[model samples]
Target: MTQHLTIVDHPLVQHKLTIMRDKTTSTAGFRRLLREISLLLAYEVTRELEMTTTTIETPMQTMEAPTLEGKKLALISILRAGNGLMDGILEMIPGARVGFVGMYRDPETLQPVQYYCKVPNELDARMTIVVDPMLATGNSSVAAIDLLKKQGARNLRFLCLLATPEGVARMLEAHPDVPIVTAALDAGLDDHGYILPGLGDAGDRMFGTK
Candidate 1:
């Protein structure tokens, strides 16, 4: 991943994102759309995966075939809401190694606090991708990246459904090498660290929680 952000604005991605953002979309409908859109985003995120040629005997003759190089990818999901995106991505990258990092914001300090973390072994040797549906304040995402770096992750990428400018800025400042891929970048964050004109509470919308 480059030291930049990529917004997957393909028609299929945008269409599904629009429906997901609508207030009338049911929990089942939203969840279904998220799963479908996740596959689309996965296409863009893994577009540049390293490929190597392998000698294979085709039905006609022997030939060289392109295949992905290196070990299975490591997907680190920022827990709770990240599961929504991770589920669909896992369906596509079925061989990927999965891990979870759980964190929550402190109401008083408005900072993220980590509670749980379990990552795969030899993270530095694999391509590590982090999934979180909404990048609101970036506090949690940055914190999660910090932990992953400590765990030996060298190649990192961040994927989200929606992002705020503040959040993106924070990530760039903290981890410029980790590129970000998102469906949309919203106007900004509200007073309480919520994205403006954004779908309210991604976890709640997907899980029917308040």
Candidate 2:
């Protein structure tokens, strides 16, 4: 991903996102749309994956077949809301290795506090994608990538459902090499770090929790 930030603009993605943003949408519905949209976003994110051709025997003839250069990819979800995006991405890419960073925003300071982190081994050799539903303050995303770099993750990308300009700029300043792929870049965030005109709390909307 050469660009710092890539926003998926497919019609299906926009349609599902519009429905997901509705206040009347139920928990089940919201979760379903998120998952469905994830599949599309996953496609866009992986579009630039390195590919190689291999010789393959077709019934009566041999031909060159295109295949992904690497067999495994590392997907690190920034929990707990990141799990929502990760689930559907997993469906599309069942062979991907999974990891999690358990962190939460401090209401007062809006900073990320890490509680747990377990990522795949040999991250430097694989393309690592960090998944999170919202890029509100960007503190958590930046912190998570910082941890991954310390753990030897060199190749990295960020996948999110929604983002704000402040968040994108922060990520660029913190980790310019890691490209960002999101469904939409919404208006600025509110006073409490919530996205404006955003679909409420992603974790809360997906899980029916406060």
Candidate 3:
């Protein structure tokens, strides 16, 4: 992956995002919308995956079939909120290898602190995609990607529902080679490190937490 940022401007993605931003939307509704939007985002994120052809015997005759090249894709969820996006993408690419990087912000410092991590072997051989709902400070996202790279992940991409300018800049500065795919890039972040006009705390909204 190269330094890139793709904003998913599809009507369906935007519509669902609008609903998710509504404060009145129920937890169930928010979760449902997230799943639907993620599938749309997944479509764009994997659009350039390499393909190879192989001969296959069809019902009518023999033909060459185009299939994905390289190792099975590795999907890394940044934990908690990331699970929402991960589940949807998994529905579309069920064959992908799954992993998790558990991290949380230190309320005082707003820095990411790793709590857990589990990933597949041979990360250097697969296309790894990291999923998260919001990219506010980008500290956690960057930290997650750093960890993945340490584990040998090379071709990596970052996917999220919303992002702020600060977060995007931070990611670019830290890992320019990793591409970013988001549904919307909001105006900026609030004082509390939340994306302005964002759908509040993604985890709280999706899980009905206060």
Candidate 4:
């Protein structure tokens, strides 16, 4: 991708995001909105996927059918919150291979600490998309992408619901080749590195936790 970042400003995406940001929105409602937004984001993220034609015999005649080229897509969810985005996208692309990178941020330093990782094989051949709901400090997202690259993931993309300027800059500096697709780019991050105007903690909101 030529551009390093893409903001999906679709009307529906923005409307749903507004609801998700409301503090009064219930957990079930938040999760439902997330899934719906995910589909819209996935549509943009996969827009440029290579296509190939294959011969197929129809009931009346023979024709060439257009199909996706290259290996099956690999989706790497950045643990708990990423699952919300991944779950929705998976429903749209059920054939995609799924993976997870588990990590947590240290409250003291706000750095990412990885605890677990399980990914698909032949990473070099697949189009890998890493999903996360929010990109605040960018520490965890960068770390996750670094780990994936070490595992041979070459063609990669990052998808999220919201992002801050600091996070986007950090990601570009670290992994410029990987394009970023987000629903909205907020003003900036708060003192504790949380995204300002963000929908609170994505994991907590999605799972009904603290």
Better-scoring candidate (lDDT), 1 or 2? 2
lDDT tens digits, residue span 121-165, model 2: 999888899999999989999999999999999989999999999
The candidate with the higher lDDT, 2 or 4, is: 4
Candidate 2, poorest ten consecutive residues by summed lDDT: 1-10
RMSD in Å for all candidates: 1.4, 1.3, 1.6, 1.3
Q: Candidates' lDDT values, in order?
A: 0.91, 0.93, 0.93, 0.95
Error of 2 at 185 (Å): 0.7
Ranking by lDDT: 4, 3, 2, 1
Total clashes for model 2: 0
- TM-score of every candidate: 0.97, 0.97, 0.97, 0.97
Candidate 3, 1-210: lDDT as tens digits: 224789999999998999899999999999999999999999988987889999999999999999999999999999899999999999999999999999999878889999999999999999999999999999999999999999999999999999988999999999999999999999998778989988899999999998
- Stretches > 4 Å off in candidate 4: none
lDDT of 1 by residue, 44-140 (tens): 8887778999999998999999999998999898989888899999999999999999998886777999999999999999999999999988999
Residues 1-210, model 4: lDDT tens digits: 239889999999999999999999999999999999999999999987789999999999999999999999999999999999999999999999999999999988999999999999999999999999998999999999999999999999999999988999999999999899999999998788889888899999999999
Q: Which pairs, if any, clash in model 4?
A: none
